[model samples]
Target: VQPSTFITHVAVLTQPSDGTAGRPLPRQPVVAAMDAGGNVMTTYTQPVSVKLNRGDLDSVGMVGTRTVTFRAGVGTFLDLRIDRAGCCLHLVFEVAFGLFRGFSEGFC
Candidate 1:
């Protein structure tokens, strides 16, 4: 029998804030799952923490982007970055057969 191939999917969730100073940071948790043919194979959840400082405008403008890769019968690897608008984050996932690539936006 041939080895199973890996696939990846990404989703973005945004929460609007008042942009107030000295306020508590926001928490955005994301969950992802994959199914092969008709069988549920894998599931995972990622918790994202974002903090905005009062005096740091440049840092506040930066958005968080993360990439996750899962291997068959193995664990997953994650790559994270904080980027400003107009920039993009790239992710590459390697499988038994080939490679899959994906990108996420920095725009809020």
Candidate 2:
């Protein structure tokens, strides 16, 4: 377990990575956090979620996941299929603790 009030060191993009875009992208953006020790904290399992909000959560009409559980401190945005958003889409990963999160920009 992590110490209370400890800050996460980093957030890494595991899917929908940089320089990869496709119509109807059949993958979800995944973000993982690493402690100061640089190890995957599997015990950090917590319900994680994110969305492709363009100033509106439901603006895209199911283009991204609404919620997904985390495994080994990794949360995946399920059913994330983007094709009509054009470019420069944002993917935010929210951890269960409500203190740690990550963001990434991608194209579709």
Candidate 3:
């Protein structure tokens, strides 16, 4: 089935919080599929992947399970962390198929 027919986009339900370099954010990010009306599309289950929106040029990049298959339309990133020190960083979450996408708030 075509995903666009079911989910309009994805949203960051739980935003990542600032944390020490190389340590996982105390509040992990959680993404979910959403319909056009801003409701969770519980039936849409697919893989969701995350990456740093931007960071220091010399940073080691994001660590941990960067991609996860959704359960009941929700993707929970349990251990996401940046390897280098930075401020006001944002994480971008996108569907594995490269369709829907979402962004987390700034963090360090």
TM-score of each: 0.25, 0.62, 0.88
Tens digits of per-residue lDDT, candidate 1, 1-108, equal: 332243343222222322223332143322223324422234333222223332334443433343333322222332222344322222222233323222222223
Sliding window of 10 residues with minimal summed lDDT for model 3: 52-61
**Could you give the candidate ranking by TM-score, starting with the highest?**
3, 2, 1
Give lDDT tens digits, candidate 3, residues 74-103.
999999888888887888888856677898
Model 2 lDDT per residue over 4-108, tens place: 333373365655632333344555566665666665555676666665545533434334456676576666564566544445566666665557666666644
Report the lDDT of model 1 for residue 53: 30
Query: All models: lDDT?
Result: 0.30, 0.56, 0.83
- Clash pairs for candidate 2: none
Clashes found in each candidate (C-alpha, N, C closer than 3 A): 0, 0, 0
Cand. 1 Cα-lDDT: 0.30
Better of 1 and 3 by TM-score: 3
lDDT assessment of candidate 3: 0.83
Q: What is the lDDT of residue 11 in candidate 1?
A: 29
Candidate with the greatest lDDT versus the true structure: 3
Ranking by lDDT: 3, 2, 1
Better of 2 and 3 by TM-score: 3
